[model samples]
Target: MLKPFLSSSFVSGTRLIQRPLYYTKRTMSTHSHLDDDCIFCKIIRGEIPSFKLVETDKCYSFVDIEPLSEGHSLIIPKYHAEFMHQLPDDYLTDILPIAKQIAKAAKFEQYNVLQNNGRLANQAVPHVHFHVIDKPNTSTGLGLTWKPLKTDMDSIKTRYEEIKRNL
Candidate 1:
């Protein structure tokens, strides 16, 4: 039998509730692809504490400790993958939808959905994770500087063709 515990949740508002089916540590650790040394894997297995927001069969989300802005959070696949391309499609399917739901539940009017790949790209963790950063004001959240490159249409078209052909 599953155990029940009193917890607060935000569906529309805070309400006392029982733990979700996936809340059990054993169930959360059942993903066969987890990386033993990974911090996220430790969190999922209850080895580390986290303010977890959501957990599905394929994904888990929680508040960011080093938030860029208020309401900053992270969503990650249950499976361990160093890069997005290495993750299975089934795991990818849950990420965006969960992110959207989290944004809505948080009542964030403006936010940025961001992800990084390699160390050069500023990916601090070697795991596939998405960030939902709330932009309550101009100074908060992700700031960007656009740097457009000057290129010939021929070069662009050739590259596009190559990608399309592979797809």
Candidate 2:
């Protein structure tokens, strides 16, 4: 079931508005087997090493080894939900608070909480994880950028109407 983003999104531009499920591609299988072979599962299970931050009942936060910037970190659910939308309801309830804690602890007043869901969207890990990157306070972090596509009004309206009808 397609649904609107739960008021957590920060994407903005003059055009090329964000669509629901735009980043999430075809949903991955909600199978227990996905857990067995998942590297994030291994990390969560203590089979692989990660610099830990916070471990709560539903998820954990840790430093990203291949960080795009300093203090870059990842927040992941304990269970192996391959996509963000595929995660259980409890995960949605649990994630934001912990992410906030991470951003605060890193001493950033502003940050980007990024979650990618498909190969095309740059979801390198099959397991669900949120990238917590602090925004520019100095020359210490990455500068996130988005160039919205320029399209004619007719084409944009046609696309909007199509998605609106579907919704």
Candidate 3:
């Protein structure tokens, strides 16, 4: 049973209608499962076509279908892991060398590495992936729009010093 919420039609004195919460719950629950039909999974299985750059027993690197830059690629574990923190250390270690190789191969002056964890972070696919984007010249493929916030320098310095002491 789901609670009925007033829709635009209902607010205008239309018929009382309700939508089931079960549908939303089912959709949410499905997100937790890595889709077997996912393009990345198919790439891992060699069922779908991809321009593979590097591959190991645990990791594979391939050019991104929708690239942020000229030579943007995705590094993913062969075994599906939804988030970065969920990845094993061995799997994590395996991808970095490949990422470095791809960056060098692209002749990039600089590169940006990015990983998004959850929906709020803009992770469209549930599968864990790291993006290595190449920056050829003075331009970095990554752009950030930030408004500088005024903070007390002494407070910032004190916080840094405290963290450094712990280190």
Candidate 4:
């Protein structure tokens, strides 16, 4: 369910823009994540178009417009959540199953699951989404180049202890 809205705003890279959003003429939604300005909300409402692959009461699956691989896809909640921590517990649990099914349907042997949070975390869109990339489907899957640094056992223990303390 979503509230009536004329349009939605979204961040494309560092720039923000407003675009049309379509609402299905439902009663006011109580979902906290249903932001009127979020692009994902517009997508859920069928405003901005998407090559949707699956639709559920609480979730939606679609192909990535900017695919890292041929079978790359995205799974999201119907509601908008800026980050995983902002989403409801059930949404977090529901999205993964949808992603798994998408992978199975594509007959992917290997893939990568990715989620980004804030800007520094490379979250281009201000909505919670999971990227499912079929590694075997294309050579560009993820294309992530990581710099691995060597660390000693004591450093590992210190890092672990730091995270534990913060938690």
Which candidate has the top score in lDDT?
1
- Candidate 2 regions exceeding 4 Å error are 1-34, 137-140, 152-167
Q: Per-residue alpha-carbon lDDT of model 4 for 10-129, expressed as tens digits?
A: 578999866433233333254545777888888877788998776655667789988878879998876777888888776664566667767877887899989999999999989989
Candidate 4 matches the true fold with a TM-score of 0.72
In terms of lDDT, the poorest run of 10 residues in model 1 is 2-11
- Sort by lDDT, best first: 1, 4, 2, 3
Model 1 TM-score, all chains together:
0.83
**Angstrom error at residue 125, model 2:** 0.9
Write one digit per residue (lDDT tens) for candidate 3, span 72-127.
Answer: 99988766778887876756755666667677778877888888999998898888
lDDT of each: 0.81, 0.71, 0.69, 0.75
Cα error of candidate 2 at position 153, Å: 5.1
Q: What are the C-alpha RMSDs, in order, of all predicted structures?
A: 7.6, 11.8, 19.5, 11.8
In model 4, pairs of residues that clash are none
**Alpha-carbon TM-score of each model against the true structure:** 0.83, 0.68, 0.64, 0.72
* Least well predicted 10-residue stretch by lDDT in candidate 4: 19-28
Error of 1 at 129 (Å): 0.1
lDDT of 2 by residue, 37-153 (tens): 788887876778999876655666789999877788998887687787788876665577667767877887777899899898889998889989876665666664689998899
Q: lDDT by residue for model 1 over 83-132, one digit each (tens)?
A: 99999887886677677877887899999999999999889999899999
